[model samples]
Target: MTGPLITDWSAVSPYGIGRAAFEEGFRSGRTTSVPLENEDWLVGERADTEACLVPGFVIKEVLGKKGTRAMDRVTGLVVTTVGRLLDTTGGPLPSEDPDEDTALVLGTTHGSHKSMVDITRDTLTDEKPYYINTAHIPNAIGNASAGMCAIWYGLKGPNATIAAGRNSGIATLNYGRRLLATGRARTVLCGAAEEYTTDRSWLEWHTRGADETGTVLGEGCAMVQLRAPAADGRGDDDALAEVLGVSSGITGPDGVAAGLETVVGNALRRAGIGREEVWAVSASAPAGEAGRQELKALDALFGDLDPLTLGRPGQIGDTGAATSAFQVVATLTAAQDSARAAGRVAVLTSVDRDGALGCALLRMR
Candidate 1:
């Protein structure tokens, strides 16, 4: 270990949007998700829309027309969520220090869905492609969101994005922690962000993982400000969560059990802990059989401890790449506030298509 890793970190989730909301959702023991109204239609599958969606929060109305046009909805969420995290971290508190060595690593499966859809529609509808939003199209690149975040904060440091399906978020966190331990950066603002609305149906069809299993169209952001212990004025004892170790493995579809086991085993070994050490497990609960199988695997891992789901989050739908990231963030927030939370570690796990499994073990405060 080059130095003491992240000693303190907070979370931001859609359950309530802030710390207070996170508390209410966790305290009530119910994570509630709302349904979508004006959904986008899936192009080749069943024609009509059938999943829950997030409310349409007019982007221009909030970010203003000028600042708004530079990004699509997916990108907007990353910028806005990361911005809020930075604000809570330093700007909101006079005691907080602005860390100049912060790095931004984003995890995304698809970026700029809204703009991509717009461009496709423009191309088919008009004889001339002049009507397409060329500016927005250019910004649709996967690295666009991560780059915008770095530029916004004037952070002249390592900025990268990882996309490995449902495990992208966890992989991104692993990347950040490795960088921190190697002395590549002082701190890292990291997590996953993906926009999956019914309105953006084509995106859903191409990347959708078993829709009948209730993959609610989810689109939003989850970001964490991770800093090295002893950075500026932050104390090592003040660590909110510790990054012990991380691992990822590829599995064939038939190797679901083996895939998950391979990653989880590697992560635990890296952390130097056993399955019993994990207090809570944040799962990627989709729906029906897939969701059931996921839970059974967890039951085998920690037989006694109950692995709970964020009630509303599941109902609203699986957040694709952001699935495990949101679960880890939301669970950490809850564990931090509850007095009964005694375990020093939490296990983050996820399984994506094509036999890919990712896992990370985080040591807690």
Candidate 2:
């Protein structure tokens, strides 16, 4: 059973815009985190003053003034990323003939907490109860970002948004593969995005509660284009990697290590691979005990192999739903240069504090 091939990809990351910038910053091994400025958005007291943000990413400034007056941060990141990817393919825009077989699937924890909170606040504080800004109403929904991506680019295929917390990336990839297998779509764009906002920051702070090592928030979007494998299983000449297998499960707080081990083992087995075959590994590595338990599970599975590990959280901070998508991108970036990496296997794993765990296997082309 050959898997779908990754034909093209793009990213709007904290490092900068486009895939090249992300690759350069990732290879340089420098952290993107910077001191937070006291902007109007950061309206209240906060414990953390540092974050990893997409540099100079204003919606209208990046995507132009038209049709962007009410765009939220997450929607802006997604639209910008998908546009960069379409540019590589020389695809038609919304004004031109659109590809009906090309679909989109995006993952997120929530759409835009800032937009939602602001809209609610206006209803409570404004002179009239119904004086809320209607322009922002669309951005308050969880599927708003994905919906805007479809309309902005004329993607008329199966459009959907998956909310799976931090494990959303792997879940999105799996869903895209199913769309290809079922003949619902010939091409699928799979990815995830997260936005940094005061509302999100405070929510995270309350969620972390007593954890001393608070995870710094980060914002970005990463997208990859997928197509069915060639008849001979070689896939496209420019294919970056082949999706081998994906597995996920829910484990309560006490069973994090055991649960992750089960999912990773299942993914490897489905891919017809052994632990020793993995050339590289990447993990979400969220801060605190959950992160430690995730590492424990991986160690129990691949401790002896000692493959190359790419750690993104320490550099990019906690990107939430985008974490696993960034992990996939990081693996692709590292495998691009090495001849030894060709035909090798890479494993990506993620665990959320609320008990979600997932693992994915990718075979380099």
Best by lDDT: 2
The TM-score that candidate 1 achieves is 0.82
Q: For residues 1-365, what per-residue lDDT tens digits would candidate 2 score against the true structure?
A: 87998888889899989999888988887898888873445567656799898988877778887888888999999999998988832222354666699999999998998899999999999999799999999999999998888878888889999999999988889999999999999999999999998889888887784653657788899999999998886537989999998999989555989999999999998889987788888888987777888888888888888888776543788999999988988889989866767888988999998899999899998
TM-score of each: 0.82, 0.95
Total clashes, candidate 2? 0
lDDT of 2 at 215: 71
* lDDT tens per residue, model 1, 244-300: 777888765655665676678777876679766667676666554455555666667
Off by over 4 Å in 2: 38-47, 88-94, 252-254
- What lDDT score goes with residue 104 in model 2? 95
Q: Predict model 1's lDDT versus the native.
A: 0.63
